[model samples]
Target: MADFVEKASEKITKLSDEQLERLLNTVREENKIYDSIIQSIPSGLVIVDNNWCITKINKSAKRYLHFFHLHLIKSDPVWNLIADEEVSNFISFCAQKQNTNTNEEFSIVSADDKARFIVVSILPLVCDGKIAGTIIFIEDITAKRQQEILMHRMESLKSLTNLAASVAHEIKNPLGAISIHIQLLQKSIKKCREGDGQLPDEKFMEKYLSVVNEEIENLNKIVMDFLFAVRPLKVNMTLSEPDSIIEKSINFFMPEFENCGIEVSVNLQGNRNRLLIDEKLFREIFINIVQNAKAAILSSKKSNGKLAINSFIKNDHYILTIADNGCGMDEATCSRIFEPYYTTKADGTGLGLTTVYKIVKEFRGEITVNSELDEGTVFTVQIPVPQKETMLLEE
Candidate 1:
């Protein structure tokens, strides 16, 4: 709190008695009006002393403190009430800031609970150019912040949806045409080789047919990837075994392992393997990732690529990590790896990773990539487990 006497003395000496009395009366009336306004304000307001103790609190501030089991006191620690590092540091710094000059806003949690945002301002009172205590204003803008986040999320979803639709529309026709050409080439080969009395263009025809088949397969993969992104499905949410998903996908990729000279190892943290996931889509997710691991290992030319697949239950989510000691991607390559039609290989479809990304998003899960050039890449997927109600229904 500032010294009212010093503040009064500096200006009072220059005024007559009648003038001073009128000024004092006007000040008192203004204080009453300000108190009324503070009480009616939606957000909390607390004026703290130099030591960060509550000096004066409005009605809203009192209610907020009571809800969070805090009391107004002198010389008490403001940081102690808000046990978040960001908030504590912000207030400690703001307390030293000149209120009239600096205006700072930061997000603060509610008493070591969840992420509750608050915008705090420090306003200083000065007497004759001397430092005085600060006045703190606390406004709860949690709902507004959440609304902004929701809007951003909606926009991202819309953009992704539109991209998927465009890719599907553009790639479907080409894929169909490629399939027709493959069928026609196969028929022609069967007809031309039927009367093989030293076929004239047999060698050239074989080479051309092989190239056509390879390209057709690649185009089909591209089409599937596009369809996976554009197509929406109703998820079957259940407590699924994470390790089983990994094992199944690995077993399915055994042929790839033989071809690529790769070995896979699994480590399950505990018995908890269940997650709320769609069995079919989850299988697709694992296939895409494991296949990627095989490709990376093959491309690197390592004697045997070591792929470590692991899953663990953490918090309210199930986390799965697929790590491969293959030729890892650089930062630039990793950034666009999930984008549709973005491939590094000359003959690659560039849709495998895109499909993996879409499946992860469908489950409301997050997938993060960490990779370095030549070292390897580790992809972490976090998927939320079904709640008890949903789990029971599935059972």
Candidate 2:
């Protein structure tokens, strides 16, 4: 390719004035075509030298920069346009690693004082086996992000509607039982009055009242769980070791695990770095997961059930995984496990995993479940490490 280019250059130099004029016109037309393509792109496009000075920018980029209170000029330092410290720092970091490509999303309050989400991509420009400059692609994703939030709220509203129907059904069963018992007690009292003016049997009264009390307690519990699943959470984030929280959650159920004959194993590798999360909420995540594992094992009716807990750090996120050798779920069941009041267990209120999902979201984390019928199930949770912790780890 290099030799072909050199030969073409030599030939061009030897051309007559008329021929050279035609070649120059053709080249200028090609440059115009290229420039038009750049200007037509919807995403903001910018080209900067190694010193972060803008060499070329497109119309979309110019308009986007104006939102940041920047009036761009050729050869201007691009960093000067960034008013948000966080965004500036990120750009600086990308500049330091210009040889590699970087993609990230950042939130900034624009000059209009409105919060906006932008995706920034930085790629190195290579010429003659040397880094000549960098290409930055900026995209405003605020509208897209808002739509996602709106969709999420709609889904939550749908879940709440389903929960309302489930709650009514759940309450009706206990209420019916209490009403039936009360009618039986009333009949017993009427029989006593008609027979010998004697009172009902003491044991009969205790038995019926006990059932009524138990049903009322169950009703109370259902309401409490429903509230917890739907209400907003107050997360108090503190730097805490995830392994310790995992251990504590496991220990809380150790007796039951032993009695159930489920062999439990834990391998913790994320303890070296601490995560900023609510300790209690984080523990609840594991507790619900572990409890589900135990239930799955019992349902499998296996003589020897194994539960494995593991944690590690990957890609600036702390990952925790729980695997159980139990009767796993089908795809349909797995998908709805996080829905409110959706459960297969005879006595399950079905809000345990829903709470887990909410807490993970509050932490800016993710939870996923993979399962196969009668084989096993694995639940994985990923929580992002704080920026300072990630930088220290990288260093």
Clashes of each: 3, 0
**What lDDT score is found at residue 201 in candidate 1?**
72
TM-score for all models, in order of appearance: 0.43, 0.47
Clash pairs, candidate 2, are none
Candidate 2 vs. true structure, TM-score: 0.47
Error of 1 at 129 (Å): 73
Q: Taking the tens digit of each residue's C-alpha lDDT, what string does model 1 give over 189-208?
A: 67767867344377656665
* Candidate 2: tens digits of C-alpha lDDT, residues 296-394: 999999999999999999999999999999999999999999977789999998888998999898777899999999999999999987542011111
Model 1 lDDT-worst window of ten: 386-395
Candidate 1 wrongly placed segments (more than 4 Å): 1-156, 160-230, 255-259, 389-395
| lDDT score at residue 107, model 2, on the 0-100 scale | 58
Clashing pairs for predicted structure model 1, backbone only: 240-274, 240-275, 242-273
